[model samples]
Target: MTTKTSQGRFFEDYRLGETIAHAIPRTLSGGERALYHALYPSRFALTSSDEFARACGLPAAPLDGLIAFHTVFGKSVPDISLNAVANLGYGEGHFRRSVHPGDTLRAESEVIGLRQNSNGKSGVVWVRTSGRNQRDEVVLDYVRWVMVRKGDFDAPAPPPHIPTLAATVKAADLRVPKGLDFSAYDFGQAGEPYRWGDYAVGEMIDHVDGVTIEEAEHMMATRLWQNTARVHFDATLRPDGKRLIYGGHVISIARALSFNGLANVQLIVGLNAGAHANPCFAGDTVTAWSEVLDKAETAVPGVGALRLRLVARKGGAPFRLRGEDGTYLPEVLLDLDYWALVPN
Candidate 1:
């Protein structure tokens, strides 16, 4: 038998400025939409009803922003983070277009930075990835860094090159879907009465809901995205003998929880920053909260953008993100900052 299988690339294999076109383009459908809603407690009106979407000027109900994000992120996992210890952080992520069913999506990433850890066992690889639709239109762009294992301890460290990433995507640069007209947005249909002017900076909202993780659910969701990361699937990969949940899984659930108070906040346009504070395992009950970080008006009439800090926790008190020591608390699972479209 001719033996042929891929072992995946290690940290030593990456070179700065190298562009990788990830394999396996995916054509999305209503199946993914149904599975996503089944995996997470999602109930956004624009994505749930075609009438609601058209009322807001969209041709049809679009998939959740995170769905598109996870699909794109999943395409790079086998090549970028198959042996990753953890995905460290995300910055400068922007959703350029809304994806409806029947759209084909592909991903490409460029190695922007590399730094070997002093221990020589691992290194951090920073990459900027772009998700493009079949038309070659870029749907999303973001920067992420992950801690990847080094296959050879004796391999010399690559020259350190850390890319300077922007802290936030500028409001002006945020792409509002063409023909998006919220002037006719219906509050009753959308589920929340609060408009853009209602959210004041520094206000905190406890979503007041919790969902315990199920190993099967996370695995199913990860498979739905076609993510091939070993850490999320192989229980024996971790010393604890438990599979790790995908970080995007937590993000989707957290965003879903936010709908309790932010129901009318539709369309995530920008991801300023995010961090997975701790590893998530099955049976952990996750709750969430949100803070109004900032607000800005958009060129689109009757539309505004809100900068929000969404926090997911296992069992922490509401509104607590970090401890006095300026580090994320042990119970904190995720800290995500992003911009969403809301009625002005």
Candidate 2:
């Protein structure tokens, strides 16, 4: 009998410069938005109400940016990281356009970098993934690298080819949604009165809330995105027998927690860099903090951009990130840097 099952591509199978188009395009609807909001404490006015969005010059409320991101990332998992050890980091991420209900999204990725780990059992693969809509317009573009186990230990190592990525996405390159105007924004409705000018370059904010991770919710979120990474679903894959929480889950949670202090940050347009500093499991109470790294003005009237560092940790005093040796503390779960559009 012939085997029709795919065991998934291992590290030795990836070729630099090869492009893979992921399967099963997803068409999102209000159901996705509803479920996303139910899963996370998301309440940004622009995405929460059509009236609010129209008031800001948009036709209707758009899906949260992370909804598009997770959808795109999930589509690529089977082709890119089905046999992975871990999804390491992301850089140069840009949300090119707003994603709304009724749009069908698909993803394609190009392998740009490859490096074998010294252990010979695993290697890192970097790919630039682009998510496009049914119209073939790019919605999101980003680079992510993952460590994947090798199916065959004796396979010859591929020559390392790491692509140099931008350390930060220049403000000039950010794509503010067309017609996004906060000139007549309702400060009371947004949940916070803080405007872009209110934030200083070095200011820090403790989000002042914590949500204990629940296994059911994490599983639901991963399945909602169609993310089929074994580590996220199969406890037997890890030595500890714990299903690894999806990094994006932590990101969404952190972003939701940020609403307390950053309620007026209406939209996320750029992701400079991100790292899953440590593995997260169910039952860990996640908390977050943010630092105003920098700010910039956009051509869009009434819109400004804020460069922020959002950190999610299991527990510790706020503002503590890296340790004395310049490594993330064990309690730190996520270190994310991104740019958001705010009322100027």
Best by lDDT: 2
Query: Please, what are the lDDT tens digits per residue for candidate 2 over residues 239-300?
Result: 99999999999999999999989999989999999999999999999999999999999999
Q: Which residue pairs clash in candidate 1?
A: none
* Steric overlap count per candidate: 0, 0
lDDT of 2 at 79: 90
TM-score of every model versus the real structure:
0.99, 0.99
Q: Write the per-residue lDDT of candidate 1 for residues 109-169, one digit (tens) a residue.
A: 9999999998999999999999999999999999999999999989999999999988899
Name the runs in model 1 displaced over 4 angstroms.
none
Candidate-wise lDDT, in order: 0.95, 0.96
Give me the displacement of residue 72 in model 2, in angstroms.
Answer: 0.2
Give the least accurate 10-residue stretch of model 1, judged by summed lDDT: 1-10
